[model samples]
Target: MSIAAIPTIKLELALQSPWMANQVAITRNNRLFLGLPRYSAEFSTPSLARQAADGSLQPFPGNSWNTWKPGDDGREAFVYLNSVHVFNDETVWCVDQGSLSAGVFGEQYSKPAPGAQKIVQLDAKNGAILRILRFDDHILPPGAQLNDLRFHGSLMYVSDSGLGGIIVHDLENGKTIRRLSGLSVVKASDKAPPAMLAHVKGGTTFHPPNSDMIEITADGKWLYWAAPTGPLYRVETRILRDMTRSDAEVASQVEAVYDNNFSGGCAMDSEGNVYFSETVTHNITVWSPTGKTAVLVSDPRLVRPDGSFISQDRKLYIPVKQPVNTVTANGKSEQRFNIYSINLPRHLDGIDLGRAITGV
Candidate 1:
């Protein structure tokens, strides 16, 4: 069933610190989790936080977890929290990209500190740190920015936006493998023009350097990904899990799924419908299982929808960060950040695809 028009409802407003919200994760019980990355000097908020009933930003777990000093270990504190993923098992996984800022305005943006790049798993109920996984320098280089991630069974696939490629991690053995490094599909398109937002004074370029958005099918069979300025592509998870396959062989298995404009984030529902936030167009586009693309929602206020979350109740939550506008405004971002939610149709609701298929 194709949705003709979806109405967006304003969920929350970030009046305290505008233009700092990045990602939103809603638990099964309807708890909201927000991630704030320290992108500019204007915003000095917690890297990872949760929204209280009164709409206040409380540091997740504790204040020490969000505090970062010069000599602190990046593994212990939240250096630069990028994305947060809450799974069906009631565990929250936070992705620390390590980079201080996106380096959009200038090269002086801070770089990733030691022990900064890692994934932390937390208990969703009480926000307790369950486990932490750090990648080696060889697998995940110092300059590599670990972007979004998706899970299929015991394996987790992470996108390296700074360094073009995908890093596969084994949850059981803690081994990692990097695939399709420097590949054209995984890297941002040089031919594609820069993305411009309407609210910003001057348009800012959005060359993500590598793949930044990713999504897995409900059945856990296919993994789809794309660079911020490149076309969509997907490959079978079986091939990605096959350790015997060579990089060339794995690259051959990747198939171009869709040719789209520059986008910020992408997600997939249980019904096999894919959603993409087209920052240049200021709209969210949906691609159905039968290979049809349609605009789900379009609004001028959606200035760079960075990360999206679909709750079990079929509500799509999107955090409007407006990164381009913030950078173009020279860190004096006047626009207010907000989290919007739109109820999706029953046919488009998200399910535990991994659990449904594997019966875990």
Candidate 2:
């Protein structure tokens, strides 16, 4: 079938804030939430926060869960929280990497506080606690840098960027399994990360997190994922959920489907088309369910499109974090961030991402 003509998408600045953010979760009711990995944080910085009607960023539920200083017992709050999702439009799901936090200069590869690493679910309407899922040492390495989250049926998937692999958690059985661990395909490619991450050089230590961003098709059968410096890869959900399958069996199921990568974040539409936010080039590329790829959007103002969301109302929301521009490279004295939204092409549909997200 021939592709539709590219629409003249209007890029609108939705909001601007003082903090840098990478990922965003939008509820069906239109609540906006954003997340960021703790980079150069101060005492009041929140890894996860909500944007209010007044345009202020509030620490998600409250200050308690968001607070974590170096020596403070981080067991109860977000230690290195990053990824967030509005699952089923009814609840909020957050993945706490539970490990490294911002050090004096940059992100530190340190041991996670006890009981800090976990996946927490909350009631979307009231921000009430729903459930918390924890992982064992065997599944998560001591230096595990958990990155992103995706759901298909009863399974919740997380990527361990610090290491290399996909973590699968069964909601029904409360069991967790690891797949594609230590595989080169999931590990960070030697090629430099695009956008602001590429600015580091000469004495600045840098490492690209592996198996970081992921997206699932509407049917929940295939998962497309990649590292920061990437060529996207895909694997069947069945191979990942089967407890009987060995790690090697799951790894064998992976296939490299796209080459032009290096994205900081990614999202999928109901038709199984995956949208990649190329941080380096400030472009959004979409790969169809059938494996064809195309440039969806290219806006120079989208400086380091860190994380994105495709709302139910047919809009692609992007957060321009401007990582290197504000932090160290460009040497800016003041720093602020902006979020943008573009209209999504109208479609009849294929899969309901909602049902895929909840596995209902």
Candidate 3:
């Protein structure tokens, strides 16, 4: 499943004024939206949350007092919003980590806020609030934060890096289960050459939220997930759909399988090859069932490729955020981010990623 080296044309979708654009997804109408994690300037202005009635993004609203504070004070009071996914092309869910705003010292010190985070779903076309989901369903340890997610029909699977687990929700029945709590199979030092912990830019070290990233197969039968800090894990939709499955049963199956360091947002081609973003190398790698490695794209311009999607035509659309030149080892860095599309040679035709030993 290898293709010739294709030249990538990088475009700056939104520059630094927006600050730390995380994951992105294309709407049904083909409108592109990127999640802006609350950074100093973005939170300071509430500009990140604002959207016009006509579907254009506007400034985010003010805090409780109607006074807009860009970001939270140097405390655990606020979190930066990171990833967002479009479920039905019309409904979108956004995740926020309240404590990331406090640890902006370039990774020297960081802490999770003593608060339960949330996932907000909004109407992409009308800017209406569909729902806001959060949970106290299960107990969690101190260092936990809700990360990326995916939806199939009426079910939603979310990663909790803070608690080091995955949360599954049946949108139809409102049934929720937090699976694999405190179970992060991928440790920080698992990869060769040591995957970098630095931010998209440079010098800022980023520890594995342990939650990493995830993507469900097109048919919603299997889920391919991995921690940015460790190995990849997957599970069947039947197991996740079975509320009766014991945690141990789920854990046992979870342990059976593991794969590469799929750090960035993931996508599947029509032929079933899993395209993963390797933050450490700044390239996109394809993983096929045959265990063949194909370099989809390898260029310094990509910086950090996050959330991605494949159109029906097999064209790959990746929203790359925070492009930086020199990492911490190289000293000083520059920021360049954008949402771009590339043509792919194959289509995603539903490939079964098999079973896994570890639970998601």
Q: TM-score for every candidate vs. truth? A: 0.84, 0.86, 0.74
Q: Model 2: per-residue lDDT, tens digit, 128-216?
A: 77888878888887667677888877778888888788888878888888787888778877776444354553336456778888887
lDDT of 1 by residue, 332-352 (tens): 645446777766544322221
Q: In candidate 2, how many Å is residue 86 off?
A: 0.7
Ranking by TM-score: 2, 1, 3
Alpha-carbon runs more than 4 Å astray in model 3: 1-18, 39-57, 60-78, 105-116, 137-141, 184-189, 192-205, 241-244, 255-258, 269-271, 311-314, 323-336, 347-360
Model 1 error, position 212 (Å): 0.9
RMSD of each: 5.3, 4.6, 6.9
For TM-score, the strongest prediction is 2
Superpose all Cα atoms of candidate 1 onto the true structure and report the RMSD in Å to 1 decimal. 5.3
Estimate every model's Cα lDDT from 0 to 1.
0.72, 0.73, 0.57
Record all residue pairs in model 2 with backbone atoms less than 3 Å apart, i.e. clashing: 22-307, 153-359, 195-280
Q: 160-257, model 3: which lDDT tens digit per residue?
A: 77657777888789988777777544233345333454344333445556655776766777776677644666778688557688766776666323
Q: Which stretches of candidate 1 lie over 4 Å from their true place?
A: 1-19, 69-72, 102-109, 195-206, 323-335, 347-360
Q: Number of the top candidate by lDDT? A: 2
